[model samples]
Target: MQVVPARRGRAVRLARGQAIRIVNTHGSQVVDTWAFNADDPSEFMSMEHLHASLGSVFPKTGDALYTNRRRPILTLEEDTSPGRHDTVIAACDVHRYRSLGCTEYHDNCTDNLHAALAMIGFPRTETPSPLNLWMNIPVGPDGQITWGEPLSKPGDHVLLRAMIDCVVVMSTCPQDMIPINGANCLPVEVHYEVTG
Candidate 1:
């Protein structure tokens, strides 16, 4: 595993067969994420469609992922690494910070994804939806949920093979919260290996 840096405001592209394993070197490191069809830049992801496409819930093993137009995007073909991943946790934005906590985290994944969206010229204004792949945030039986601790370990990661050429953008969460972003700033690693 490589602990590389995803500098703030930068975008990344992961080709087919190449999967990204976002590591929470410490724990509770929040990672806001997004995916798009590389061939069709205008075509992007919609959490609504994704959740519905997977049968009105966050994707699980063997779930069928579709694009904005309901075209096949990816299948949860494998999740052998991490024990859990949050599909509903929303990436915090400047507004959220001002209202919920701090405005300092405004330049995090949400902003980065928005910059990326504008750069790609994708018509998205409803706020960029990011999938928290490794951060530990869960809902309890009493309907009370807590976003704390770490879900995956040092080597635990998620592998995603693109059904089509796609753009993957991530924000190495800089939110230095005890329950989110690990309370300590650190780096992450990304790798791609050809399979198909």
Candidate 2:
């Protein structure tokens, strides 16, 4: 298992048939995840497409995560949590922090994604909506959403298998201003490993 340090990110390469096990090591961290086709960075995982394909805002085990071009990119083969992962919220960025009253620079998932990909020599400029692992954004009957605390316990994991060769990026979201990470508003590290 590899550690995605608190408020940081990591990137990994995956071939078709391989799977990545993302562990909620701390139980409270929200790992913003994204995937892009290995041969074409422009083609990436799309949350909108996934919502349409799944016919629901929440993805569960055995669900195929789709891409912008309406093709399967990753499959959620397993999940060991309460199944409250979020699909509606956008990845937190500098603008988001500014709106939250931050005056100085803030660490965000957007920057983390770019930095992580660049580290792997797979630079990408677009910031697509991520599959927020363990995030809890409850939708009310009136269609309103509320930022809720994570429902996963420590050691919970989600296994995602690649449908094609791709680059997967994960950011341990650094949103200390909100309780999205948890009720304590703390950001922490998580672990992940690739398996055949």
Candidate 3:
């Protein structure tokens, strides 16, 4: 188990069949997460393929995260939260912060992902859309999405099993401009375990 400090990121290598559990150590925090094939970093987790294969934008237990090539990379094995996660939202970037009226440089998830990957010698590139764990983006009756508070409390977690050997990157989301994370950003914990 490792703790990823607030507004920071962590990278972990998971062998095939291993599991990574992300814990919301503080309630209402969102974790921006993505994964890449260990052998080929260019082939990263694809939200489009996952939604197409699962027929739902939100993942649940038994659902597999698909790659850009539509191959399984990880499987959603367990969730202790309210099961409201977002796949349509892109990771927060500097531009996004500026758009939100911030004139100064702000820590963003995109950069966090890149920084974490760089530690392991992975090339930096534009990241793919991430799986936002513990985030709440609710669709209204009219189909418009709005940000909401995370349903996960402290100690709540979601476990994902790697279907193939992969490198997972997670950003303790720093979007303080919005209500996501209860209007304040906080750290999360990552636990890597092998389940036989």
Candidate 4:
């Protein structure tokens, strides 16, 4: 809760022993996140190990998150307001724009993710599965899924602590077709704190 304010078009970096909390201040903001080691760029985050650590799902508060080498990377230390954080959600990409009914969404979240990855010296991969922090996409009994109303109210946040010297970059999603981006498409604030 140190509240280091981050803005749009700029990326924030955090070191080991530091815990950061990001807020979806308005409502159901969608955040696409990635974690990597400051020591090595190749030491990336792996969803496979992440699934193994928390059973194929995204972590809530107190869940441990794993790295590509199966090492402890982050722990979901806090969730002030609960929402459906999507681990299985696909990142928006050009292919998604083409196939998922709109090419206009090209310069969206997936592109931002790729930009962030490339800024960190990683080759941008295609459509990485995302961890939708505050967005709500409900799955029905028939396995059909749809975006839901705003689950995170203003001042609601999720906190994460780095186990290693990890760099996290996020894109506050700007999709308008769904309720995934809080139904308003606003900005979010990310803060860092060294809490060893």
Best by TM-score: 2
Which residue runs of candidate 2 sit more than 4 Å off their true CA positions? none
Model 3 spans > 4 angstroms off: 183-196
Clashing pairs in 4: none
Question: Per-residue alpha-carbon lDDT of model 3 for 1-196, expressed as tens digits?
Answer: 6777788888888899889888787767789989999998888899999999999888998788999999999999999888999999999999999999999999999999999998888777668999999889998789899988888887888888998899999898888778888765444444433454
lDDT for 123 in candidate 1 is: 47
Poorest 10 consecutive residues of model 3 by lDDT? 185-194
In candidate 3 the C-alpha lDDT for residue 76 amounts to 90
lDDT by residue for model 1 (1-196), tens: 4432453433446566665544455444455667777766666666667877666434665665677787765555665444466666676667766775774545556776777667656545444466666666677779677866665565444556666677766666655544554435443443323345
Higher-ranked by TM-score: 1 or 4:
4
Which lDDT tens digits does candidate 2 get at residues 1-196?
Answer: 8999999999999999999999999899999999999999999999999999999999998999999999999999999999899999999999999999999999999999999999999967599999999999999999999989999999999999999999999999999987988889999999999999
Evaluate residue 173 in candidate 1 and report its C-alpha lDDT on the 0 to 100 scale.
62
Please provide TM-scores, in order, for all candidate models, with all chains considered together: 0.72, 0.99, 0.93, 0.79
**Model 1: CA > 4 A from native:** 1-10, 14-28, 56-58, 101-105, 115-126, 141-143, 183-196
What ranking emerges by TM-score with the best candidate at the front?
A: 2, 3, 4, 1
Instruction: List per-prediction Cα lDDT, in the order shown.
Output: 0.59, 0.95, 0.86, 0.66
Sorted on lDDT, best first, the list reads: 2, 3, 4, 1
Query: Which whole-number lDDT from 0 to 100 does residue 119 have in model 2?
Result: 96
Residue 84 lDDT (model 4)? 59
Which candidate, 2 or 4, has the higher lDDT? 2
Query: Comparing candidate 1 with candidate 2, which one achieves the higher TM-score?
Result: 2
